[model samples]
Target: MNEPLIEKTSGWRGTRELWIQAAYGALLETGIDAVKVMPLAERMGLSRTSFYGHFSDRKDLLDALIQLWQSKNTGNLIRRTEAYAETITEAILNVFDLWLLPDLFDSRLEFAVRNWAHSDARLAAMLEEADIIRVEALQSMFERFGYDTVHASVRANTVYQTQIGYISMKKDGPSDPLAPRLERMRTYAEIFAGQPVTDAEAARFFARHPVNET
Candidate 1:
């Protein structure tokens, strides 16, 4: 059985966000090839003409997608990492929260963009630049925690590369359940932070970022 396309909101005449979101969702679920205007229009149950009102063309949409990735992933992450933390471990834990929490950062979107980059040289270059920005932010966090420049850089690379590797490697299995997976992530975070997050701290974080199972 096939699901029906989602209809547009009634009397909706606004900015380009809905269309952009549709494109992003398509890119995540399918690939760059699925990001064409007609398919997205079909999914949104909107006329093809509506997309033109928001974007000049497909290239415009792609450009918007790139901008969205930069602002959402890199910009938001740097801000989160730079937020107040009493210790280096806490600071790193703050950053780890973004990875663990889906609402903060979309790992599937990141993977989709990386897959898109494999075929486009210019996109690949842009992705590389974004990666540098992200790693530099993490390095700055380590430096703020009193690490020497060299060691901070190395630690930053370690954390960032571990995540990149995880996304890059494709696995097929009946995965371990969420609780165990999250526990393992906590262990990984503790290793990176050089100490376990206290129960109170972990509780506070969970309160703020309750997992969305829906």
Candidate 2:
């Protein structure tokens, strides 16, 4: 969780990034309704008027948060799909790194923005675009591995939708054992890539994402 942003009662109006951080933290921790100016200003220990120095209004701040979500979550996922890999299975594992590596994609922000998109039509469209972009990237990944377009499309959607559904359901646990999950990832690779995940490929994947080593 982000600590409350501090601003003195004097002329220190606070930076735009500071206000954006507070707003983002609020949106992720609470819900979109809690991202109003007064609540964020009160939470940040700042005056309501000070927020205008950074953004025109709460809507502006929300816009920034949406952009932030796109850059951090969707952008990273696309990059992961484009990463270097020698085989289709390895390429699939490369994309899986986004789920295992915390510094890559912001799952919390993804979840929050997805929930926020439910009532906002503009955001809903944006979310759909991002999802299409992501799935296209995955589809290209399969295509690069010599799969035909139709087969690639089906497999990519399967991989992308399965992960998105997992994220939406929020079934993550920090203290869960890693070994079984590792095996699950292997099975996932075989299913999605339509090929076996070799021991070496699994070893290399885990090497890059050893959040909890054996």
Candidate 3:
């Protein structure tokens, strides 16, 4: 039986989060087409008693998924770019934290959404809007460092699109080792921010994100 999110007194229909999680799993594993409510209920071991007490329809679930993506992925990225930092490199490193923390930016969901957009004009438009919002946030970060609007736009596009491309190509692939990846981040910061990462700056980041190195 699907455990009720509430106490024993609650209904057995399962919480909205359960359905959304199952929908995300299905979308990531198979494709968007597999995210119907009945199959999700079956996968969740729920009774499938027309028990959609949360979302009214499959489209409702899908909208929930997209809203979650918007909040986690794009919302976090914007907040990162806006986070307090002493230098452009530090600012960019703040943005880079998303690459490490899936809680901040779920790359698998992002990839699936991008692929889904190919056949979804509405989603494709939303994607373009999201890209604009993301790049503009990066641009604003650059502007804080005294870059001209043109330079900021170019650099922001470079950083944002490069990461998007990386997500698309990195599907289901193991990431490169952390130590080497950390080393390359120094170079990446300089390239993206047009500023070198100081040893102190790099040390702060490395210390914050420790590698087991075992």
- Best-fitting candidate, measured by lDDT? 2
- lDDT per residue as tens, model 3, 102-197: 888999999999998998899999989999999999999999999999999999999888888889999322365777777877789999987789
Q: Residue 134 in model 3: shift from native, Å?
A: 0.3
Those runs of model 1 whose alpha carbons end farther than 4 Å from true positions after fitting are 1-4, 8-15, 170-176, 195-200, 206-214
Worst 10 residues of 1 by lDDT: 170-179
State residue 155's C-alpha deviation in candidate 1, in Å. 0.6
lDDT by residue (1-214, candidate 2, tens digit) is: 4345684767778889988888888888888998998888788877798899989878899999998888988889899889999999999999888876667877878889999999999999999999999999999999999999999999999998998887898754234566676678889999999899999999998787575553
List TM-score per model, in order.
0.85, 0.92, 0.92
> Which residue runs of candidate 2 sit more than 4 Å off their true CA positions?
1-4, 7-9, 173-176, 211-214
Alpha-carbon RMSD to native, per candidate: 3.4, 2.4, 3.0
Model 3: colliding residue pairs: none
Per-prediction backbone clash count: 0, 0, 0
Residue 207, candidate 2: alpha-carbon lDDT = 82
lDDT of 2 at 204: 95
Quote the lDDT for 36 in model 3. 83
lDDT of each: 0.79, 0.86, 0.85
Model 3's TM-score against the true structure: 0.92
